[model samples]
Target: MRNNIAEMEFLYSQESIATQFSRDKFHQFLQEDMIFPLKGVRKKYSKNEIIIPEGEVTNEIYFIESGNVAATKDGENVINFYAENEIIGLTNLLLDSHSEYAFQVISNELFVTKYDKESIIEKVINTQEGYFYHYVHMQNQVSQMIEKEQLLRLPSEQRISLALLILGTKFGEETNDQDLIGFPKSISKGMIGQYTNLNPNTITNVLQKLQEEEIIYPARRAFYVDIFKLEIKLDQVLKK
Candidate 1:
């Protein structure tokens, strides 16, 4: 396995060379024109901890360097957040382009980069790529979520099934001789409603219906959904 951060850090000098930026111009832009620092504090968040909340009026952005996260509200996991330099909180403020979900770390993670409100504005003014990259990610995120919302506009039963379909496609993993679908972290029922158009109560009702149909089971708080059967129902209904 690759050496983890702690071991790697101990192996290197504190003042050792910083990693080169992929494009030198971006680095130059950050160093001279941008107000953000060379290296901000590396924040550490444990599993299930909220890194940022939905609709909060703040321009702080984080570029993930390690660990996975999930976005949710009141307890249904909607989006699985990736690292790989993906950004958080780079979208517009006054416009309707703001964040629609809260991000929580799914495990202990080291988040490497950050930019507060003023620094973000300065960078946007100075570097087109800087602004453009964030805008593209924001646009992609919003569009995907909007498409998901549309898909879930079906009756509560179908919408609930579609949610499982998405979770299976992106985040499912097998366990204990079964093709188990597990949530990386829990998401709020209220958040699921925002995506599904069905209110939390409706969602709960649909969950109960699926449970009665033997399509899913609730373990403690998290629900284990049958992704294959859910997809079969979705395929049958979505075509209608």
Candidate 2:
């Protein structure tokens, strides 16, 4: 049981890196392909704009050119986040179901290439590379959901630590210190609470403990993490 738990946690922690690589390759294909430019329309969204409302029928696919968007449950709980080079709406498009969450632009400005569902099916999905991208995308999405569910089942401290580590790996920028990584200010403590389904007070307390331990520290515009220290601390927590 101990070995199983440890192995599961290791795979969950590594999912972000795997997802990043898949997203990059998928985006690269879209960028190089001529079908996208011919069949898709480019659009820009301002911050806080709703791209898709909850329960709405998804009719189009969106490819992010720049900026980020968040998928929220009932306009509050952030279920997921999509950044530049990521594609949204494919799941809903393929499933032919209503959107489970509201997607909103989180960056100051978001640029995306939008493709109607039919166009995507007939133009992109029919192609060999496109089908492969879709398969990999769906696989990554499933892995993320499974990992997130497992992380949420952990104790608050471990949950928060692993959540930050995943987010840091996906969206963070490397700092001068090879061991440190910096996540954008958009990944606030409140966002962390929402993502983990934890109370605000609990999030605050756990974050404070992490700070005191020097595993993570806050900057004016970002959260800086000592990746090595954080992994060690998380391993200790898991053993306990």
Candidate 3:
């Protein structure tokens, strides 16, 4: 049983590492040398600013130059959070659908390069690197959607834990403690509940339990996470 647990940990770590590498590659493709030539307008957005409102038709694609954004449905349910180097609006444009969620700036400030749908499509078809980046971006989007679906099916505690893990992996910064990673405090309990489709009370309870366990703790304007401990907790839950 111990061996099986170890194996699962190894598998999860390997998958996490690979996913990180893919993310790095995607960002690498977004460098100035690649994007500067594109006919895109660089724009700055203030916190809480709406980039695309729900039900609007998305005729543009946005590449984050800096900062964070969130996609929320009905102005409440958080569908996803996007950080630097990530692309938004592509999914809706590709699917020929209206925006189902509002994309809003969650950071103090956001800088993004926006390109019209036709211009981006033309670039994708005309440039080898653009085509590759587009492919990778689409792949990552699908993977994220699938992961979110899987987490939502988990029991409340596990679902919230996994959600935090995902957010930490994406937005966390290295801390003085080697075992702890810190993510923005802007990601509140309410946002976590919305992200995981759980009640606010449930989010509060689970977070309190995690804090008690020392798996996650609050920092100054950030939350410090012990991912190793959290993964062990998840493994233990799975064993049950």
Instruction: Report the error of model 2 at residue 23, Å.
Output: 3.8
Compared with the true structure, the alpha-carbon lDDT of candidate 2 equals 0.78
The candidate with the higher lDDT, 1 or 3, is 3
Clash pairs, candidate 1, are: 74-188, 75-187, 75-188, 75-189, 76-187, 76-188, 77-187
Angstrom error of the Cα, residue 104, model 3: value is 1.0
Alpha-carbon deviation at 155 in model 3, angstroms: 1.0
Worst 10 residues of 2 by lDDT: 1-10
Q: Candidate 3: where is the Cα deviation over 4 Å?
A: 1-36, 93-97
lDDT string, candidate 3, 11-114, tens digits: 55645534643544644544446553455789999999999999987788888988989999988899999998778876644635688889999889999888
Off by over 4 Å in 2: 1-37, 94-96
Q: Residue 164: error of model 3 in Å?
A: 1.1
C-alpha-based local distance difference test score of model 1: 0.59
**Clashes in model 2: which pairs?**
none
Q: After TM-score superposition, what is the CA distance of residue 213 in candidate 2 from its true location, in Å?
A: 0.7
